[model samples]
Target: MQKILLLSVSAGAGHVRAAEAIRAYANIGDAHLEVLHLDVMQYVTAGFRKIYTDFYIKLVNKAPALWGYLYNSSNDAQADSSIEKLRQKLERMNARALLKEITAFKPDAIICTHFLPAEILSRQLKKEVLNCPVWVQVTDFDLHRMWVHEGMAGYFAANDEVAFRMQAQGIAAEKISVTGIPIMPSFTAVASREQCAAEFGLDGKRTTILLMGGGAGLGSLDAIAARLLAMEGDFQLIAMAGKNEAALAALQALSLRYPGRVLPQGFTDKVERLMACVDLVVTKPGGLTTSECLAMGLPMIVNAPIPGQEERNADFLLEQGVALKAFDAVTLEYRIRYLLDNPSKLAEMSIKARALGRPAAGQQVLDTVLSQHP
Candidate 1:
């Protein structure tokens, strides 16, 4: 059996989630393949690991402007600041254990959902010390300079625009594959309003809307929920406050306040099921969540995508006509009401979303990687 090493860093949940999706596909689609999923953060020093994940969360949440500045300013070859150099040094020093694990595993194909491991292996491959092919999966609709490293076997992109951007940055076209961002296979399964009706208490009378914020309550879900509930319409809200206890409590309280109009869910594993029940989703355009929505053929009303990757993801969705971007609560409320009033437009958007979704992208990536093995 060919060994598959699936690597990710826990900078945010999306990278690890992408890796898990691919691993799940590998297990279910090919019994002959041996797979191992490793979070590279586990092998790094605790301080480095903590900083890698925590700094990202705090920076993006508390100091978004500063984060945006860093994101936009560092996306080029010329912008090699001292912090970047120091980060690379820290990674090399702390990830020695990870290198040993990869070298020992003797994986025939190494796939990375995050670019940090890919960068380390790029050096090893260029030195001819690592013989296996290393492929990187870009988990966002945008490409950053860090993900563009020497000696990568190939890259899997979220969409055509990302592929084009990589080429513009000098990555060869042949080295890139426009595979949609992978999600858990469960999202690809066919489900219906009838099927999910029993759980979320859906009815043919009221339009159902799903509200989520990418598993951490990062986006302004409370404000959006309040605005939507305040509006008069024949609609209901499935408020999913993923992993946010306070948000969940508030949403539950709102359910009481608005009786039959609000259905709040905490961190649950049944997001795909919820999508089946809803007419449309209001969410942030994180790559994994958007991919899930697309796979389910559900239309999106995306709001407040952070100024970097999420913004680009929202752009792709809007340009594809699968979603609409809302700048604030009032605009979001307007879009929701407009869509509710126009059922034909919602159906059209769903059709476009399905057209753009690559439900079997995980399997495609695995087959391509193994088939092209050096």
Candidate 2:
């Protein structure tokens, strides 16, 4: 079997989610492929994951400006060394062990969904210890300097804009391919909205809005859902309280009060189905979710995108005329009502969103990796 190790991180859900989608895509047929999904953070200590996760959440919530500044300022070649050193220390325990295992697999190609493992592998290549073609799959529409490395065999970006940015940063133009982020196969192939609603037992007549807060359910989703429900509109709400049992229970209790109008879901693997049925999506603008929404051609009401990467995603969607941004409860409610009331505008946005979709990104990336290695 041709070994293809997929590396990702568990700090947030987007990276691992993207990695899973690619793995699923690669394992569809009699392709002699052995896919291993790894969380690089798991190789590190528990304290390391805690500190990094906490710091990321706090930085995004409490100090967005500082985060933005850091993101913008760190876009240089010089910063790569510091980042690599930090990753080395975090993965010190199993770095060599994992590397040996991968090398033993004698993989034809290695794919990376997260940057940390890519960085480690790049370091190994620099030292002449690793000699495989490394393909970096950038999940976000915007490319940071960290995502661009000197020795990457190929870069799969989300759009032409990101590819252009990579080319500007000294990466060869031929080495960059604009393949939209890989989403679950369901997103690429699913039933129509009416069919999906029938399957979910959702009323097709009502305007359905699906609200999500990534995997951890880390956002003020309750407030936003309440505000939407309070608005006197003909809309049904489905709030996905991802991986947060307390939040799901709280929303479930609220759903009891609203009865048929509100539905709360726990962590589910059926987001593509939900997106297919929903008229509008209200969620934080994580890259993977945003890409999935685009694939489903669902118009979005962005709640709160984190300052650095997600902000870029929101901007890209807005520029494409496929989404709108509403930062607070009142604004979000108004936007939802306005869109729901005007079917023409909603139809137009959805059309634009579908036009921007790239459903074959996973296959495209796979082909690129195969061609380069062959």
Candidate 2: TM-score?
0.92
Candidate 2's C-alpha runs over 4 A off are 80-94, 214-219
What lDDT is reached at residue 266 by model 2? 89
Candidate 2 lDDT, 1-374, residue by residue in tens: 77777888876788888889888888884367677777877665567677657677778777877878877776643654887566556655547756876777788788899877787788788888888888899989899877766578888989989989988888898888888998876777887778878877788777888988632222366656776788887789888988889888889888878888877888888888888778888878888888888888889888667778989999999999999988766677678878978999999999998888887777788777866765
Clashes of each: 0, 0
What lDDT is reached at residue 16 by model 1? 94
lDDT computed for candidate 1:
0.85
lDDT of 1 by residue, 1-374 (tens): 88999999988789999999899898897667899999998998878877888888888877777877888877753636787787778877987899899888889999999989998898788889888889999999899888898889899998888899899878899999988888888877757768677766766346889998632232456666777888887788888888889888888877788888888898888888888887899888889889988988899999878778888889889998999978776677789888988999999999999888888788888888988973
Count of backbone collisions in candidate 2: 0
